[model samples]
Target: MKRLKLLVTLAKKGAIGEKVKITLRELADELGISPQSVLRLLDEMEKEGLVSKEVLGRKTYVEIDHEGLAFLESLCDAISEALYNGVIIGEVISGIGEGAYYVKQYAHLIREYLGFDPYLGTLNIRVLFPKTVFDALCGVRPVVLPGFTKDGRTFGDVKAYRIRINDIEGAIVVPSRTVHPPRIAEIIAPVYLREALNLKDGSRITLRVVKG
Candidate 1:
């Protein structure tokens, strides 16, 4: 697994089947080993049908094979599954009042991706030390809604992660991009979360975010 991960780090330009220009010395530096050690690892991987390498002059081009990609996919899935099943506890808070507008505008896309029509607004949560939760959530694949031009303005993509709040189905919504702060997350559910959970500002709640 460590060697496979090292090969994945070496293929930085793209995924399997995409050409990447990398050198054994660079790989050794990245893997914290000798160039000869990298060569041995590459030989082992090539024998196992995981990678393909070519030598041209002093440069080496590397690419991962289908089998390698499949293995990586499985590894990612396992990691995501392990990390995805966690609890997030936070205090309910008031948003900037923009949730209604965006949620209403993107209702169709949200429903299409999340399989449920969302309530008109969001439930804001102020988390405590949310770095781990944020990283784990970001590690998994998110349901993305493509941006579109509306009212002479272009709205960016939105990402949603299926979640459950006290056993009620919901999702965490990140508007625009993946570069969000770890302090807060906006949640949307099929019903009004505030009313459903009898929540108010300063109320603490627990959420379960799942990947599969």
Candidate 2:
């Protein structure tokens, strides 16, 4: 588990295909362990073909090996399957009043890729789970809404995951450049979910992944 955690940490630091210069002390600090323990874990991972390390002068560079990448991908698949087979619970929350504007901006793309014309606004939910709501979307493929330039303004790409809430079909939209935290989910559906479901702040909701 420590080796896997180390690999995940390295991957999060953008060390998948390319080398990332990191120190044992920095890694130890991040993992909350001693530098010697980190070194031992790295040695084990290296022997298992999970990572590659190189040294230059006083610098240490590390990268995830192919096997490491494969391992992470498999883990993601397993997590996704487990999440899909179950359900995630969250509480209704209010947004910063930007959902309507963003939804209107990507209306066309949402209709094209998500197969529905979303309502004017979104239903914000604060996921109460292991951590980020993204945990439920581990290996699931998302419908990518390409960014566009309009009226001298540029919009970033968005990723949409199909979901079902109380038997109502909807989607969770995640903007590439977003101010929202990982625990917050912005949902879009064909109708106003708040009115349709009679929801309010602190209302608990269940979300189920709809596999395509």
Best by TM-score: 2
Q: Clashes in candidate 2: how many?
A: 0
Root-mean-square deviation of each candidate, in angstroms? 7.6, 7.3
Taken over the whole model, the C-alpha lDDT of each candidate is 0.81, 0.89
Candidate 1's clash total is: 0
Error of 1 at 176 (Å): 2.1
Query: Model 2 over residues 1-212: C-alpha lDDT tens digits?
Result: 77888999999999987999989998899899999999888888989999999889989899999999999999998886665463668999999998899999999999999889999999999988636777777667888999999999999999999999887999988899988999998999999998999999999988887766
Off by over 4 Å in 2: 1-86
TM-score of 2: 0.62
What value does the lDDT take at residue 11 in candidate 1? 54
Pairs that collide in candidate 2 are none
TM agreement with the true structure for every prediction:
0.58, 0.62
